[model samples]
Target: MSTAVRRRRALTGRGAGALLAGLLLVIAANLLAAPILLYVALLLFLLVLFAVLVVHIPRRSGPVTRRISTDLLTVGEESQVAVRFDLRALRIPHGIWHDQLPPAVSGDATGEFPTDNGTSIRYAITGVRRGVWAVGPLTLHTIDPFGFAQRQQEFGETRTVTVVPEVVPLAPLSSNIGAAGGTAHTSSTRLGQGSDNLSPRFYVSGDSMRRIHWRATAHRGDLMVRQEEEESSPDALVVLDRTARRWERQGPTADVAFETAVSACASVALHLVQEGYGVDVLDSAGTVLGRLRGHEDDRDGLLVALAMVRPQGEARDIVSLFDGTPPGPLVLITGHLDEEDAALLRHGGASAPILLMTDPLPGAAEAAARLGWSSAPLRDDIGAAWEDALPARMATGGGHVQR
Candidate 1:
């Protein structure tokens, strides 16, 4: 919850009129030499001054508190805001309450201040964009009984509302892709399957004697044990290239292209998780942004992280990320991409990476195609791009799928 102190002081219509009349009467009295007019003017001046003092006096009130309807608010989502304040006594006869709202949120947060103690106001707010927005310091518009003077008082600390990036549902990976288990249940290779199919290898120091293969050990003149492979869920990487210079920004709101990329990253991560894949979100520079294992809480955490993610970093190579190991399935979402950048990504390992560019530079598409990468433009409808990448993914067998 947020509040503020006195913000401004000014004269009301009645106060301005009285002061002007008082001055006029004083001038008239001097011109006509009338003592009666002078006395009336003095009384009028006193009345105006008294009204100002009356409005400026302190009023008894308790601390203000605010509440938001939901813990999670996404961009373009609406939520209710309720503010409560204790007005023990009213020093001024009339006043209005206005809750201050930041530009990141939109709503009407104003009402008449109650004459009695304990007052509350409720209004609706729509998150205009993603970010942590300050809801307000409640402002009170106070006026004197005669409506001669007015003052505005702000109260309480501002409350923060976190608006996360919008997460859209994306299409599951095609079955032919043979990469993710989203479309089908993957089989586990744990020992219980069948001993006949299990292969034996030279026993290591850590091998248990109970698992030693006597038949293989006799033939090779060395101890051997059945190879043990545990069934594990598939995993994928969603990389967002947040190069600041690549995206164009509009005042207040984030860059449209960058926002689209963020949404795509979130959607892809969540979709892969739902499809039974352990997902890791990363930036183009190979920094891990978030990791999800198909948990309810983890999904929310990922969205929150992306909500505050900003475009950063200069040109950096991503080849180091997959230097010696293959990234099972990689999804790269970025703003602009040039031919050089596309060629640089080719050495990042053969996970049959999917490249989504908001603005693909000239010759970049040709370079991506030549490198056998599935490429598509990231747009408002993420499903379209997902669909476009499906054929390429299926043709290349997307990524290595553990059997």
Candidate 2:
């Protein structure tokens, strides 16, 4: 509860008119020497004063509570906000109320305060942008019974709602992806092994002597066991190049192109996870932003991470994100790809890799194609890039082979 009360009082239209009239009457009384006119002026002045005092009197208000319908909100989605406060602390007056909303939110925040039915009010708001938005400081506007004066009082603290990027649906990975040497349908061979299919792996603490592969151990000169890990899932990677030089910034968030890239990254990762692939979301500097391992995992966490991602870091070669290993279902979301950058990325082993660019400089697309990368210009229709790259991956040979 806040003991501090901030109040603003002002005269209504009628009160202003009355004060003007009282001034005129006082002038007339001085000119005409009529005591009757002076009496009328004094009454008018007192009435205006009384109205002001009625509205400005200090009054204590009870604590206010606010509640939101959902824990998180997605862009363009609506959420309900409910407010409750005590009405008995002061003599209620007929007035209107408004809830202050940030620019990122859209909705009607004003309504009649102290409804005849109850002491609570509810309003709906739609998230217009991605980020944390504060919606609060309910303000009550009261008018005197005679409508001569008005008062405004703000109550309660601010509450925040997180809005995440919209995740659009993406087409399934092309069937030819696996044939082109992508591990989209299977786990990375070097990372883990399947229980149903026996494979060699380093011995763990609980490994049984019966499951040891002595021949493999002797060949590798290290103890190996046939990993029976049932929890292992196929891995995929979504590399987001947010280097500041590559994107345009509008403010704290990147421009529309970067927003599209973020959404594309989210959609691609979600699609892969639904298709039974463990997805790792990485930035341009080889930093892992978020990871989704199982189909049943909570995806909101990943979306929240992407919601806060902005254009940062200096320009660097994206090849570092591969970490010298053959990546699976590789999707690189970048901006302003040039020939020199394309040439440097050719060394990685991502068979039929998908390159989604916001702005592809002249000759950049050609170089990417020459490196066996399926390239597409990113746009509002996210699936267009997916569809365009699918056919190219289907026709090309795997692993940096020229088309």
Candidate 3:
């Protein structure tokens, strides 16, 4: 049979008073007449003490296991964690179970359960922040059948849960410019392009008939197919502005500009990938999130990276980062743009598309005209601007206009 051991505080009130009276009576009998009365009183006191000890020892219950609804959840979503207690070893008259959750989860309260073979308790909480949260080490407390003593047991095993930011489908920004206009320079050395044949040269020993440019060969004396120039694919680099000066002026609540920028970048990247283009991301701190590789489903990785991003002290010059490469389209996403940055972008060797995201700058229109790029204010009505800025072909998939 199962056994329980308990340590309780000394008795008080009626019990203490009765014990004192019995002791006094015993002492009085010993001092006066009746030795028999003294022996009887001592026996009664010893029996009462043994009975109290027997009632104090509490019975032990079986172990418990806890399970949560999901190991990963999104912010603003509810988490339901259920704890199951096994009581086959000993019958529990009453018990209390408390599950400890991370501070990010709120609205949790202590729960009580009546004695039974099996007890399941549930806790409901809502995740308010984005990050990883751990839940476990449920504390179990039990009082003796007689309610004179209590015991506590802590289960150490724990589980980890990740809470990600809620993803809302933002209407594409009106001021989004296609990163496609720039000069394409050719190199002396020619490498094989991914495109199919344009024309064939003089039949080499191993040349195939399929590459023979028939139309050109008909006009020329020597056998020739359409000679195709090797085309270089445009590289899509997303530049995110993260300077402290840009975000520090916002109110106590987190600045929505950063969130808007991140969402815009993510949305654009997804669209570009679907259009068979290479995409890369560059932050103000010089950290690169993605490389100019073929598109894949990397939305989760990108969002998580954005979640931990914070404003930094150092500033990044857009021109320096784009120096020395062939002219290709560049996309800049920022809250504010200074004259130096604007001049560099406008005069930069490559044709650039600047997406200026600001909350109502004093001279936004003048700055945009001087830089020769489109500009749109950041606001709830931004959808119209995004629609206008997006290349008509991109919306219709006809073909992208060269900048």
Q: lDDT of each prediction vs. the true structure?
A: 0.76, 0.75, 0.56
Model 3 agreement with the true structure over 291-386: per-residue lDDT tens digits = 543533365666566656666766666556644552233555666655544454442544435454654356654565466555555543333444
Clash total of candidate 2:
0
Backbone clash numbers for all candidates listed: 11, 0, 11
Q: How would the candidate models be sorted by TM-score, starting from the highest?
A: 2, 1, 3
- Considering summed lDDT, which 10 consecutive residues are worst modelled in model 2? 394-403
What is the lDDT, from 0 to 100, of the residue 196 in candidate 3? Answer: 64
TM-score of 2: 0.80
Identify the candidate with maximal TM-score: 2
- The reply for model 3, stretches above 4 Å from the true place, is 1-98, 103-127, 136-154, 170-234, 249-253, 292-297, 322-330, 336-360, 379-403
Where model 1 places Cα greater than 4 Å from the true spot, the runs are 1-7, 183-231, 249-253, 322-324, 347-352, 392-403
